[model samples]
Target: MFQDISCLEEIPIPDSLQPTIFIQNSLIKLVKNECVDKFCRIILESEQYKTKIIVEKLAEELVILSQIRQNRFHLISRICQNLFSESYYKEQLRPLLLRRIFRESSYYLLLCLYNDQIYSQNDIMNLILEQKRSDFAMYFAPEFGLIDTSIMIPKQWVKKVIKHLSDYQANDWALFKEYRTLGWLPNSIVAAIKKDDLDALLDFEVDSRFNINNFIEASPLEPFRLPRVNTYMSLAAIFGSINCFKLFYQSDIPVTDRIMHSAIAGGNYEIVRICARSVCDGFEAAIEYRQNEIMDWLLQNSLCKISSAVCMDWNNLLAALYLSDKTETNEILIKGMNEIYEGKAIAMPEIVSSSSNYF
Candidate 1:
């Protein structure tokens, strides 16, 4: 069953007339089970799958599996290696699987491995150059967790985004035009834009009188500055700051490397992960979106010697902790405390003291 999956991205999800009832029914039932190994069964029954959903279901299972069994991550990688390296199932499985690969902890390691493997086989920079050819078709990147497709730009909405940009650009209070233009509508920007007083807009929002679609018109403003800014760092050319993010390099500011702050402030997971060089941001983005699979992957990886920066943003951190279940909450607190002692976690004392119940 080992298929040449590296070339899988080359294959497209073909439109087929075949019905997917068997696989759909079988997998759905299997997905409902609280086991990760069932994913292997689902994979084994691949012949019955016909739609793109089997890919999603299998991915979900893999993530669940990884979260609970960090030691087995090598096995997980092998499964992935098999799917991508084989040709027989390449067209049918690879396309759907790679999209979900980043959702697994194995992906983080695999990406590093691919970098080394490709270097041995070819040139290093050439591999980085080839990345753009991957499904970065939209402004968002899955490496950042699922892109906020809700912020997607259609041809028709281009005018709406631009019109708002022109109107908001002149206002110092609305410096978020750049982020909005980049295809992101961060929740912080959403709450930050309304003038610092109770107004008709706020009223309309509370009373459900305002059009929710108006969210696309608002953007993130640079209200807060990184006092420890990376001297030569320029936010100008950071094109997808609103929707996606690049990794934080050695040039990054350790004191201000709050992954959650970067993520929810702009809602970009890539920026979040980039800062999480060692610590976990509690999977702030996925938690915000109730993306259980993504959150699971993060928690699993955090156990493997990962860490984040200081100056932790409370709003995002609290949101993540509260959104968790009993097991998740305890794990988060323990891991967070350990990181704090190790100086990997950010300090937000007031937040640590206050207890908010999350549903």
Candidate 2:
């Protein structure tokens, strides 16, 4: 009998009967499409197909495809957990799944550690160390009491891990104390500023070694130097951590036009207001970064002056006209320029076409 089995969804499975070849091939397609509900129903409800070697091969394909896509990891975990309840599936699939997960991603490895019954704590720790995932190893080792002193943390990750530990309130933990004793910690003041951990900053201030002037007077390259207002405080503005910026501001650190440029790039209106001083470079940065709010703010606040030699350059005007996405922003820029050059009778740039209405 010639049968049309092209539409797998329409195929009806009879009770207690083996799924035909068409249904089996359709199951593979379902796995690829991540149709979890239908895949599980068909596999679990069917008597013959679930026990076949093809099911094991399908599960392996699912893991490989999910890893490559960098998503649907939860579905993979759910599939394994559901299938693992059966002794035959568990015994057949465990080693293959674990090996694939270990080779794919540290994130997936960590997920398997928490979600699967396959890995012991020691196994996870070893995998973390092998992967050089210091962030994971630092917390996991301390939490599970699996600290391996011989494992070397990369220098770049050490400070970030320290900040994470403090954020998690793990400073009092023995591992933190051990890090301090071993001189693995960066400058506490800088760490506190970067973390916005005001409490830790206060505690450090009470120490005899804590000297605010030492940080302030230190050269920019010095290890003890305070965070730069232009760099670090600008980041604080981006993150909306006004308290951290205030901390730096109250310390009487010198502010400069570079700070305004950085704040403008960050696109925080309040920081731009607080740090506003020079608009020459700030306006250029705003134009380059396409920060419309900052551009509007600069024009509205009378901060931009095209009469300034810096802004009068043809390149600056051309860039502003070409890069501005909105006609309103371009008009604002031209209006600001016109206000500055009022009564000079100097003609506007030829690049300002009538179509843009920037006259």
Candidate 3:
């Protein structure tokens, strides 16, 4: 009898023949066979089977079977994915599946449903905070347009979201503005700096809480090392924001060699000129980025010498030089390599020959 019942799934029954009794019996057999596809097709095709009682019963059976079957999560999640297309099924199944899945700690399933737009913003936020899943909450909330509810999120999470937005180079002004209003002043400033939003940075400056000089002087490494206000002077250089660089430089933010390297890599001659007087050397950065103009300027201005003993990563620089066919730049690099060999007692030919292997 069960074999005959299971065979019924292969043939599409007429709509009039799809009574509730047939569907209920077939569903039990299908669940036994793990025929998730046919089970969903029967539910979706039959309007009568979409009722609350039927879906609730299916959910119960799946929950029970999931405990017994090792791959029950995958099977049930696949069923949910199929059922999500119908509005009525989506509404009915979401809560039932979420309740069962959440209880089982099947977070990947929860995330799949969340991505499918199963959870409302409030539902996810409450779920995340209650479970203390701040990592998931910080990234997921902003992406789902839940920035307005950021106040309810912890300060640390807010900082993390700000850093996330900044790192990904997302330009959500509404989100940034909200964070700024919440007294996460320093983090917002660093985000603005990293994003090269001078106007937004200036707007942040007007607030009495914003002590521009003091803010520049202080460097907090809480969120991550990259988004700190002091260390991010290189951001302006790399982004080719001369005005922003001027703003940071005038504030007496110390110009490190990294900043000069970033300026060289960015190929902005003006910012490079500004950083040239301050930083010790940018020879490797110029060669690596193939910034011929900056390379020439550095050498002509005597800002960086080929004879400098601090030629860190000579193989990388040599590879860059070998790849660059520019006669003038190659001459400078070859001379620099010779100078390194003469001064530092390092062999040049073997390193030069091996440099091509980097490609």
TM-score of 3: 0.34
**Highest TM-score scorer:** 3
Candidate 3's residue-wise lDDT over 1-359, tens digit each?
Answer: 00112222343433432343253334323443358787778778867766665566566545544332222344556777788878887788777765665455443445545565556667766666665654445445445554444435454645665566754335665554344322234446765765567897788768988764442432221211122343456766765667777888888987887788777766566887778677769887765443444555665566765521223243333233333445554554455454543455355544444443322
Model 2 accuracy (lDDT, Cα): 0.48
lDDT of each: 0.35, 0.48, 0.54
What's the best-to-worst order under lDDT? 3, 2, 1
Best candidate according to lDDT: 3
RMSD of each: 20.4, 20.2, 23.4
Question: How does candidate 1 score on lDDT?
Answer: 0.35
lDDT string, candidate 1, 1-359, tens digits: 11222321222221331122222223222332233346444555566443444454444544444332223344545555554454534565554444444333223333333433411223322232344322221212212322233333333333444456444445542544334332234333233232222242244346555443321321212222221231111121022242212212332434233434333233234554554554455454343333333344455565222112111342223223333446644454445544543457555443344432311
lDDT of 3: 0.54
How far in Å is the alpha carbon of 149 misplaced in model 3? 23
- Over 242-352, each residue of candidate 2 has an lDDT whose tens digit, in order, gives 567666567775555655665665555666667764334467655534344455556655676332222323223433443444656555555644443343434344324
Order the numbered candidates by TM-score, best leading.
Answer: 3, 2, 1
C-alpha TM-scores of all predictions: 0.24, 0.33, 0.34
Candidate 2 ranges with C-alpha deviation above 4 Å: 1-130, 144-153, 156-239, 247-252, 261-268, 278-359
